[model samples]
Target: MNKVIKIENGTKQGVLNFLEHLITTDKISGVLTLRKINEKGICDYGFISDAKELKFADPFAPVMPINAAQTLSSLTPTTKPIAAIIKPCELRGFVERVKRVQGSMKNVLLISYTCGGVLPLNTFQGDGSEKIIADYYNAISKGETPGSIRPTCKACEYFVPMMADITIPLLGNSESESECSLIMNSEFAIQISKEFQCEIITSELDSKIIDKVLAVRISEKEKLYNKTKVTKDGLDELVNIFGKCVGCHGCSRVCPICYCVMCDFESHNFDYNIEIFETELEQKGALRLPPDTVFFQIGRLAHMSFSCVGCGQCEDVCPANIPVATIFKKVGEATAGLFDYIPGKDLEEAIPVMIFKEEEFEEIGK
Candidate 1:
């Protein structure tokens, strides 16, 4: 049976109060959530053990400095239960990490939201940041997508998370009504609510409102893909797009799927030998300072195309402003479609590359 609970103390405060109650009453040992670090609106994930410290924690903050999934990879398989508040996309990324054995879901109570997307890091840290945040919540209150959000977020269809222990309905909710709704998904969520002594109401989200949001995102995704897609014959176009790369590897660093500690692209294998440089210079008359920029992008794409979650962290950090997320999203969608796979959707579903089927792609082999 589906269970819902409404906290009547406004959206952010109500959620915080619930979390505080859990901590004070010893429901969970700690919480892994986004906490504001300073007045500048800079924030990162904080693993908080004390209920009093949650004053700095803002689970609804519209800024994502890093996907919390990568952090979970480093901090999980815990000895005690930890409640993690993250966006739907971040939870999906965590599932991908867990499947790869980079993290464990042993004692995690995942709390996600009907996401309204997030601001790009630049905009979040820039001038009038407060106005941007205020405007963000305003859009949510009105059941409209915000104009100022990460490009990848505008196109994301998976804003409503699956596989969460609890889900907070922010997208289709009216915060002015002074009620915060929680969709208790897993048994753990129900148990926690009962332990906290909260009334469990049976209600569901308004599908009409959610569908309206989905329609806008789906339409935005099509337009984004068309704008950034690299065609089979568009090598020049590909170069024109990725050619601005500074070889910083920021995209890989922020990618949840690129879990390799030692990337071959940064290894001695790709080093510039004097002879190879001379040969390349002789042939092309001019060599780009950092050679194989395009090669690196394509190679990384091949490595993660099946698992890319379209978090937009890559483009967020890219100095060149390449639509790295969009390109990867387009390719990832195509590759994952081949196997009818959606990464991070199910814990039991094996990654297509990790499992072998004798009859799989039989027509191609024939």
Candidate 2:
């Protein structure tokens, strides 16, 4: 059964207080959430063992320097259970990783909030003041799209946490009000409530408002996909789009689904001998130094596009300012759509490539 808990204190403080309560009650070994790293307004993940550290917790901060999914993957096969407050995209990415055996969900409790989109890391570094962050949250709560939000976030349709144990609903809530409803979506959440002293109320979610927001977001996502759609007409278009790739492999590095310990592109196979380089030069008149840019991109797309969550971390870290996220998201949508699948939608739904069905993809056989 779903349960709602109302917080009389401010929502931000309510979240912190709840985290503290969990720690004090020994419900979790630690809490993983964002904390201010310095006075420069920088914030990153903080794994807090003590309740007092909740003072620095800022789970609602509209900035994602790194996808916490990769961080969670790094902590897999963990020794102790912990609670993690994550964004919708991060939760989705983690779910995908769990299915691939890159992470474990056995001892983790997911606490997710309605995401209002986030600013680019560079933009946040420039002006991530308290007032700006507060104003952004206020705008989103009011169903307004502030211009500072990243394009990837603006186009994101999965802004609500569907797979979370506990979800904090912020939509349709008054901006002036300090409190919002906490929804318990899983038995674990109900169990936690029984142990904690918070009042649990039975209330239905405002599905109408959520649906309206989702419709708008889906429309935006379609527009984005159309704008970035790739074609198989020719390699000229592909080369033009990826012409500036300097082979830094930033996209692969930030991709949560790119879990290979040693990628083929990074292997010595890509390294050419002097004689081979001379042969290539003789055939093509001249070759680009550090060849096979398009090869590397297509290789990555084939390898990981099925699980791409479009978090924009790849584009965020790219030195060449390539629209890596847009390309990947567009391709991922088509690839996943081919199997009538949605990445990170469910834990039990086997990956399309991993499962074979006689009735599946009959069009291909035809």
Say which candidate scores most in lDDT.
Answer: 1
Please identify model 1 stretches exceeding 4 Å from their true place. none
Strongest candidate by TM-score: 1
Clashes per candidate, residues 3 or more apart or on different chains:
0, 0
Taken over the whole model, the C-alpha lDDT of each candidate is 0.87, 0.81
lDDT by residue for model 1 (155-238), tens: 999998988999888886876448787889988888776866556688877889899999999999888877775755478988
Clash pairs, model 2 backbone:
none
For model 2, give the 10-residue run with minimal summed lDDT. Answer: 171-180
Worst 10 residues of 1 by lDDT: 225-234
For candidate 2, write residues 289-342 as lDDT tens digits: 668888998988898888888888888888888888888888888888888888
Query: Against the true structure, what is each candidate's TM-score?
Result: 0.96, 0.93
- Superposing every Cα of model 1 onto the true structure, what RMSD results? 1.6
